[model samples]
Target: MTTSVSEKVYRRGPFPVKFRCLEVLRVTPITPHVVRITLGGEDIQGFHSEGADDHVKVLFPEAGKQRPVIPTMGPTGPVLQPGEKKPDSRDYTPRRFDPVAGELDLDFVLHGSGPASSWAAQAKPGDMLGVGGPRGSLFVSNDFDWYLLAGDETAIPAIARRLEELPEGARAIVFIEVADASEEQKFSTRANMTLKWLHRDGAEAGSTDLLNQSIRTLDFPPGDYFAWVSGESLAMRPIRDYLLNERGTNKSWVRVTGYWKRGHADHVHDSKN
Candidate 1:
């Protein structure tokens, strides 16, 4: 999940992140609406993704182009070459990173007519995709009395990764909302976790109170807990406020992010904590 441009969340990384021009090794369908694109090559060397919630910007060149014109790390920042088409780009979670094999798996949700979704729908093996940053890793410690994780389909990659990385015998509570049962995913974790699946059925995404309502009804585990919440911007606002105002959760330990905002063409992540 991306932190709001305005908030200071926990993160660490080697600055001036490197860029990699990856090739699509294979494209496989993970679900009815989700696809896993496996990217690898010699360029993936030295790739480091230590946080479960790390995200990279995927650059898509114009149709029929072999690769996008990627920028270099300039003395100041990214130095874009002159007179070149800037390809479309979007942030996505790194589902799996195998440095030994030089492979990085990214999951994409195909729901909109946006460039990223459209590209994934038609992508094939040997296709070129540019990736940059992560710029860093949001490393939330697993050392807590318990953990609460909640979000929609966009947040699944991070949520699943966190569950898998938690120590054995640790306690976790998870809630995920999606289109229906078909969108629900199975997660394997050694942590003591209670997972709940909420279906929107026919309701429009980001136009309901399901997430907030669920959090209010559940009897949360006691003691020091780190809560991570992300999804539609409007839907996340109430939940964040409730946790801070009503629950009195510590500001430093809580992270609430809007992976995307409704009614906005570009999906920008924003957070209040």
Candidate 2:
């Protein structure tokens, strides 16, 4: 990757690790289920993200009101009791950023049930919300030589960002699993990327049927390559073993995150075990 003033990025590599209130400047529906929102605020000027297997938290306004009721302080952290009158929070990927112009774009999956998804479904102009990220990044150097990237829609933004930032001649295979063919979208990039969008006609987001089939059939060539996989936390188990035990992948080169679990909300992974 050559240096160019116009193509420079400040995000050290994903996780920025700070929270700020940003106002919604605009929202555009890219598809029937994918909505993109443009946010602006002075606080956004300092954000930087690597956008590879990374995500950010989006604090939403109350369901029935403009302002949320989450307390700045809590017994544990920033949480309230059940049935609390706090605004909902969702995780999303930074689709785009323009630090110089004080603008950041976040794309949302307008699925039902989830607070962030429902809010984005009905979100309108002049809405205000809190945005935070740059928590830090998971890095995989060109050391592997080749790479394999796979995940669900929640992983698409980061996957696309990585593709665009990869070295021009980098050899990589990317698989984005989606609900149906209609949900598919092209990811623009300069790297030699082979993007395969897999659609599970009636499958849910966290299911492993399609993801498992896809990973099991992959043809691993002879080379020191790496893999990055995320999505349903539970489903990643088999793939983790395949890469770590079967393929003999380097721990440093593979980043497999269980972004979400089947029965939990605001989920995360503590220890790799």
Candidate 3:
């Protein structure tokens, strides 16, 4: 029997959006510039995230505030309470979610002086943070013959999660770019993965063509493959174009995203083609 496209590509949920107030349970430094903050609380009871790239809006408290101001969930959507200021928030991938333990892990890359970076740098066990909505999930079937995963430091959390979730014997090729050799991360996965770490050495993030240049030289193995590429906005454009136009990758099987853009605060771009 021939496989149907819908059966191979699954999208689940427009889950009811829920905003939770979670407390930081621990802060672990993963690298010189990356920190992992694990959050847990009674509020984590109903959280759901199945997609490797699922995102949650992390609301940060304003200066002098003990906790972030959360919005009311209305029939239409999140409604701001009257006279209340909306807290500063940024979208972040859910690195790991353990429902049995009611814990969620988020990895933060320390760069510049952004709100998220600043909050993570000094975060401790007692810190309170507001988290809202994975909203939905897009589950790409792992039955593909092989996979291509590429990104920079910001994309590591999602890439790591995906790699770990792949079943035994699955084939995966990964390309990751980081600030330097010191910023590289190791992952534990059952899949047969060929992983490469690209170092910018001392170059500024988003200012180099390292990811695109590296991808250009890859000699892909023959198979039905799923490609996922994400990183700096401008840097990702050429890589996305290369995969779709030059390599003739199926549009529906490729996912490209811009986790952030240079000079722009809290920016995210997604192309599903």
Candidate 4:
């Protein structure tokens, strides 16, 4: 359950293991291009997922194998057969993780034709999957005076989730870019969030200049502020550079990440692009 604003949420109380195996408990569609998959078992009792944008590494089943191989605490991390391959992996924000209920929620943008996207699109209840996390959370607490949240469609779930988590009377500006206006989402946030939708009706998923062009014009507030931006490689770079070079935001206050690149087939783990 979400804690009320009147109560202080404890961060150091407990956090899930750095990594652990999780099974698929259920999967449900939130939108035409987004699916929410909850994964866990008795193993999730200790998991503490604090906020939106916290990622978990999902291990997929290897081809021809019934399931993904669970790693043993070995000398060199993990070891598999010489020719065996690890399942395609992706990074996703933890929408929620209920420790008492032993369940964890992950939201996936089911647009890419990639393995991870396709898997979530076709996933069903009882289907087995693997998860490892509560790895770490990107901190953009409401303690700040203001915030600037921007991203493409792939970042929608996390952005929307964070907005809803903001305390009442807090302030943040949100800019969401999508393929078209029809892809817009209805969101609920306690904070005073002003959202601007940037649409590139026919342009490729992450190639548009909409987000950069708009952010360039906005005058940022001087008080303590945070900016969280995520999306394709080409798009993420411009935003990160602008925040770093122009606004002089410390790397800690500005978390810009490239979730996936347009032409790259594999997901980027530590994207500096």
Candidate that would win on TM-score: 3
Candidate 2 achieves a global lDDT of: 0.72
Order of all candidates by TM-score, from best down to worst?
3, 1, 2, 4
Relative to the true structure, candidate 1 reaches a TM of 0.93
- Per-residue CA lDDT of model 4 for 153-238, tens digit only, reads 77886888889889999898999998776677889999998999998878878878889988899887778777778888778887
Per-candidate TM equals: 0.93, 0.84, 0.96, 0.83
lDDT of 3 by residue, 85-120 (tens): 888899999999999999999999988678999899
Candidate 1 wrongly placed segments (more than 4 Å): 1-10
lDDT of each: 0.85, 0.72, 0.88, 0.73
lDDT of 1 by residue, 113-144 (tens): 88888889988999889999777777676778
Q: What is the lDDT of residue 221 in candidate 1?
A: 79
